[model samples]
Target: MKVMRILLGYTLLCSQLCFGQSKLHFIVFADTHDRSLGQTNLKTFHDLSSSIGFVNTIATYAGLQPNLLLYEGEKCNPKEIDQLLTTLVVGKDDVIFFYFIGHGWNNRQNNYPSFIFGNAYTDRATLETISRNQYDIYRRLISKQARLTIVIGEACNKERSDSPPVISKREIEIMSPQPYDPLKIKALFRNWSGGFLLSSCQRNQFSYSDLKGGWMSVAWQNTFTELCNDTYKRKVDWQLFLTSVQSKTQKTAEKNEQKQMPQFELSILPFNGSTPVSNIIPKSNTPVSITNAPCPSIDSYVNETALAGIREDLPLLHEMYDEIDSDNAKEYAGAFGLFFQNQRNFYNKLGSMVFYEATGIPDKCRPTFDKNTKWVFDSTNEIYQRISVINKYTSNPNKLVQQARSDLPSIISRLEEILEKFDK
Candidate 1:
């Protein structure tokens, strides 16, 4: 009877402890457009997609899915962001992961950094007008039952003066709302728990991007993917992950002849450590696509030395096609051969302008070159579209195969014009 009584008492205690445990949640926002750069919107769109994949991958591994993932284009304003935050009910046992990717700037007047989104504030708006009541949402989040919070800012503190002229206008400056001081915020929660702030770059430094996406985005994705793939299956450590991301971002920046490095600030309750990353992540058999096949290095397409690297990679691309052909993978080989062939043909067709585009072209010819390249890229993208169609069609019916054959001649004719133009 005593043993039975003890067991009953223990079971109730276990139930209470289990019920009190907090779960993990995430909130992600990528304000990809503010009009400071001509390509900022497009870049941010790509970044947002990548961010979604990163978060989703982690959640899949951890077992718990994100509570909310919000991506805003031109319509996301401060009020809208606050409203979204209000929807979440954070608990003391829960951990919140917040991510922002866009232009960021330090408001000297306010002594805080802000992330700029489309319609963040009017051009003439002062710091007080833009940042007023903005950070209260974050404050409210931590003040509640949440035990840990992570904030990742993939934004620039200043407009990169060295960014290519083709990317942005000289007249516009896109910046984020000033962020709440990390130390101060941590102090507020010092007795309660801990929070981490990961910034893309240090103060006075600007973040960078290429056609692929922002370097910081690439770094985070890479680090997370590698961690997931690690053989040890060890617990996830933020410090270790951040260190790896910083290294990767710095190397990428240096290779592109840019200077940008990620930075972080961590403050958490010093008591029993927070949850092990492995505790949240589950084991999965499927491989992550973002980490498995990364986007081609875009920096190689952006500079003279990098252009040479692209040229050197052409043979490898052809080799990839040949390997597929050797395996009698005709359907895939055609797509592979055409995709790289189109990329090479497009670059060669443009000639010295590729270099000029990466560097600086004369103002007179700049617009013309930009127009031509855009046309070239659009047409080349069709090859990728066909590849997708080919992938979807099965061999049993082969109707799509016949359609692709019918479309080939027109595609050839369009490609031929570029050669003809070169000959002229």
Candidate 2:
């Protein structure tokens, strides 16, 4: 009996020691070809091939295998890109990463920045029309699905000159009708939360590509890879990853006698503190599905406050559960009393918070939260009932503790599954 009790205590302790984490889904694509509907005068980028290689390598290392890797000839028009991103369903806990490496230019009329997709627009006027409205559309599409949307645009927003420059000039004369301010383009995402826009260079500054691939692409690839190797066992710090990419790419641009400093904006609010991407585990070998789930309709936009709260609280709850169960036989009576009191307090607090949020939900989204409230009430009741049954086994206090410890895992697993719905 003593040996079995010790084993149960060890199992409970191990559960408390375990870490809680989640994964991110990444999509990487590049527009390197110049089709212009079969125009022979188009200029194709040979350097973009390296962009593909870097995305694949980093995606593999990070365990966020790309859901879509659109290369040359892939449909990248504003409507098509928007349609593709809109198809995926993102959860509040998940993040979406969209990376583009190709030609970008400011409209000759209004200076709005736009990325050129393969064969999308033939004339300058057509490209300008698409560029004018595409930024807001893209930002909203990506932002709606996930908790965070990260965009990495490694392209130059300059005039389409008769001849592209060999080296970027530090100071270029302002040309009206073309927007040269990177900050202006970045401002499009100012109102959104959990958005990070990383542009390869400031407005008017040019991004370079060579046989080695894009300078920005190479820098980010190296940064993600090195973090994996350096951390070995620890989770990679997302902030550090972003900083390293900026630093390395800046160095490369300086070496080429260019002042192509990368510009970025990040607006994610951390739940507790800094958020880290966990290391890729063995189970992450499978790739994420590219096919979109059924698009969520109007009532599907559920608030994730309670779900996020539960996820954040689980680690601490596990610790408390384990500690209360570890008391020796002599201390069992007192420990059980304290455990019951704490359990009631914790659940009441969490349950009431969830109920309050559910009741106050606006009319349009009431269905989703109403369902979630019932789920919470039912699950908590089951937990309370299980604990009560365990407490009734007063004749064999050790057996009571063992049964409760054995049952807690399934209850926790059920709660986790419930939380995962908010992500999908």
Candidate 3:
């Protein structure tokens, strides 16, 4: 009995140690103190923090342990980053996700951007002391040889350009309300093994952002949310996932009348001496018919509830625009206040509506739905651009407001036309 007890104790200890070594490590590094892009950087950190929490929850559901470390604000400096990289310890089976968002510029020497860790951009000494290339960071992390390493830098890559580039929703409300599939989550975080690098924009391009968040970061989060919520996909295709993120990022940039093309490099290492291409590619491309799919309900909701909601709000928008265009300052102030509040809700609703239409609707309606959704997104982005301009307060506020007001009528008309087509 004593010998049997000893054997059992050894077995449990081995199991515990093995589990600890295979844990996932998620690290976020963000410079949230830059004078120009401070607020946008902070928003990105909050959004990503929420995303990390979601990942932790899913990891726990899959019976895996995840460790998260956040270095932001004043703590996000070069010394700390280097120290962390130098002293970090990783396991062979561990997964590492490192993300950095801040003001960055390319030197025309390396493909990656150099992060400006110092907030005092005017101080040449400070800038030189704090700036670090993302390629160096990637190399140090990959040298640890964890099962998988993902390095993402979401910042402008413009060479010698002056422009500085830049979530949680109601927490659980924005994520899929349904129960998550543990196996799928495991497949995504655990099954894959490789080093993946992502940049928000290509060479000589400026990554764009607004008061909400960086367009690239928003697109990345949205794509991940959709993938996590999709329980019907037979396999998690990392290649497709990256492609979708790239496409969404570009589309969002174009909608805002800007240009940003995200670039990514993915290398899937061999598993057990077998090729990793099979793992990267899904076994099939056909969409799986989800059991008890919400297609019909979504169709009805989009055609009835969503469109009616927009129609009801259009009159108020027009009224606010009239008041803003009026000569009275008091009326303009009140109208601007109402416009800000209403536009936020309206934008959020349109975003949710488009997500549902894209994911839940049947294939037959996809063509028309795609066209309508594009129009809606593009118009909303136009309004968003005006809002951003007014919010910046860097120029004459009244002139910007008037310009936005001037463009409102045509945008509203197009929205009304889209609504008519939807009704039909």
Q: Is candidate 2 or candidate 3 better by TM-score?
A: 3
Which 10-residue window in model 3 sums to the lowest lDDT?
A: 166-175
Candidate lDDT scores, in order, read 0.49, 0.49, 0.64
- Alpha-carbon error at 160 in model 3, in Å? 3.7
Model 3 lDDT tens row, 41-110: 8888887676545456544543446777888888888888889899889877777888888877754324
The most accurate candidate by lDDT is 3
Q: lDDT per residue, candidate 2, 169-254, as tens digits?
A: 23321112221122221121122236556777765567765545566766765664565442334444456667877888788877
lDDT for each residue of candidate 1 in 1-424, tens digit (9 for 90 to 100): 6995675456445533543344556665566565654255456555444554544433333333346556666544566566766777766556677777666564321112457644533442332234322123344555554666777776666422223222312222222223122222222222235565677776556777655566776777666556544242554455667788899888877776668888775555443445433222212111222333443222222333223333434454444433443234555545544553334333333333233224323345446656655755565456445534544443422454454454454444444543343322
- Candidate with the larger lDDT of 2 and 3: 3
Those runs of model 3 whose alpha carbons end farther than 4 Å from true positions after fitting are 1-20, 50-52, 124-126, 165-179, 270-424
Give the TM-score ranking, best first. 3, 1, 2
Best by TM-score: 3
- What does the lDDT come to for candidate 2? 0.49
RMSD of each: 21.9, 27.7, 16.5
**Against the hidden reference, what TM-scores do the models get?**
0.47, 0.44, 0.56
Error of 1 at 342 (Å): 47
The local lDDT score (0 to 100) that residue 388 gets in candidate 1 is: 48
* Candidates sorted by lDDT, best first: 3, 2, 1
